[model samples]
Target: MTKAHHIIIVGGGAAGLELATKLGNKLGKKKLAEITLIDSSRTHIWKPLLHEVAAGTLDSSEDQLEYLAQAQWNNFRYRLGRVIGLDRESKELLLEPTLNDEGEEIIPERRFSYDTLVFAVGSLSNDFGIPGVKDHCLFLDSTEQAERFQKNLLNRMLKAHSQSKPIEQGQLHVAIVGAGATGVELAAQLHHVTRLVSAYGLDSIDPAEDIKLHVIEAGPHILPALPQRLSDAAMRELHRLGVTVHLNQRVVEINAAGIVAASGVIIPAAIKVWAAGIKAPEFLKDIAGLETNRINQLVVKRNLQSTRDESIFAIGDCAACPMDDQGNNVPPRAQAAHQQAMTLSRTLVRRLKGEPPLDYTYRDFGSLVAMGHYTTVGNLMGGLAGSMMVSGYIARFVYLTLYKMHQAALYGWPRAILISLLHFLRKGIDPQVKLH
Candidate 1:
């Protein structure tokens, strides 16, 4: 029997998992190709939901998807390791040693060869060499980090509630850098959940008086990437939520005490969060001679293959695939990732069948920003009707549909429907916010 072509997908993120599932069903099930997915994480959680996890609004245990189980159901193999280096010439990858909590080696350094390699490693929070940001500020880039923030936030809340002393200047303050979607959404979520946590018998810390939330943005306005009208709407909503939105305030430095803005204002914060810009992993810049942008994102052609090699492809936040010659590239949105995954699934299938790969054209389905449980605001891209801004319940429904769409992609319609029902049932059975 002829050996099946090996297709190794690294990352297991939204793009990687979706691609693996589609291709696994299309090719692996038919014994056409051997599909394998690798990642440093044992489970996968949708990145957009990280804010919910950090705010204690969503429990990670309830939402995280285990890689081994998903692979078994989807007809792919799973490998737990981080790809440290790439050897394009030999079609091989080097994985770093995995260690346990005691610093003992759990998995030794290893190498894996592939016939076709797909990179979906995703991006991380870029500190831009900022002093003190790394040690002092919390990041929401991964589940572990989000959980750490969640636990710390809970502890601080408990301490403040139990104390007979008045809250210190920075004790109940939260300064969030970057007013992007993640930062903005998190600011709103923290406001809501903290108030809930306080209302649920933690009366010492007054949610309305003692607690403070600051959204520090360097840009002229929050949601700089979105339309000015939408940004204005979001700001209005945020203001009503009692959040202090600091506009045009560039963070010069961050410490345990607070953040110092370029304007020379010190915003004291007990818990600091950095949700600023993102860049691909540090090692990807010149990995195996692959072209990379200043942010270290792998540069790829329109077909989503690396500029230097066709056998390798990249998608999601890690790949810099141009949408046009004018230096425009696909936006790092979940929608774009989903579309790229669908396109690449077809691309890989066609390649195995000796057909030309199709070019990926990102369809802008607009964007949505949810303001916790209150409402959601965004513009929906209607094919011919141009773009129209949506808010309130309609927009909130659409915002939720995005995640439902993702669930449908991964688990199909039946399981997705059941999951939705379970979520509804959970509303009555579980606490509105995770207390522990």
Candidate 2:
């Protein structure tokens, strides 16, 4: 009997999970190939929604998908562990021993052999070795981090509300060290949630006067990767909403009190969130001697295969794929990852049949920024409508559809539809914002 082709996918991010589900249904269900997904976390949550999670505007527990449940339903095997090392010659991936919260080992160190290995481990916040950032500031890289920020925010608000004296200047301020989509959207989300907090019986605190939101950007403009017009619009909205935008300000250091800028401007904040930049996990740099970029992202060909190994592939923020001859690489985005996952799924299937791989060309459907209920803004690329800027309800609807698209990929249309309906119904019965 022919040995079943084994495909191992490391990391259960958007791209990794979708690829595993597709390949599992297409091959694993038929016994043509064995599919396994490995992730350090037991559940998966879309990374884009993390800002809302951090702001306490969205409850993560209600939205998370359990890895074990998804794997069993989709015909794939799920392993919980972090990849520590790789052996290219032996085609084995080494995993660190699983540990519980008390630091006791649950699963011993393990290794899995694979005919094909795909890396989708995703990215982490890039602190650039700035002083006090790693220890003093908070990050939104994972659900636990986001929830920690939310808990801290709640405790701070509760203390301020219960105290007799008036809140001090900058005592309730939030310093977000980045004006990228995450930072900007998080500022807006927090602004919206602060108002809701007062309505929910934290009436002693004035949301507009006590809660100050600061966005510090090293670049000249917010949303630097997007169009200038969109950036200008977002800037106008932020200013109107009382959010302070500090442009061209490089952060020199972060302390428990606030952030110090190289421009000699000091902003005092009780909470600081670092959303500046991203880099792939450190282990990826020169892992198994595979080519990688400065950010530790594995350099890949147009086909999403690593430059040095045909049996190895990468997607999402962990892969540096060239977009043009001028040396422009594909920008790390959810859309790009979704597209890559779809393309790689087909490529893997063809590989099983001894066929040539399909090349992937990123189609920029557009970019959308949802800032709570204030509004959504984005540009639609290509298509009959051509390039156009949109906002208001139309833009918000499209922005939500993006999440639906991601859900459709994982759970199919029927289940995705039911999930959406359940979410809507749950909102009516539950608190609009997460209080605990």
Q: In model 1, what is the error at residue 238, expressed in angstroms?
A: 0.8
In terms of lDDT, model 1 sits at: 0.92
Deviation from native of the Cα of residue 135 in model 1, angstroms: 0.7
Q: Candidate 1 at 410: error in angstroms?
A: 1.0
lDDT of 2 at 328: 89
- Cα lDDT tens digits for candidate 2, 58-147: 899888999999999999999999999999999999999999999999999999999999999999999999999998999999999999
- Estimate the TM-score of every prediction: 0.98, 0.99
Off by over 4 Å in 2: none
lDDT of each: 0.92, 0.94
lDDT of 2: 0.94
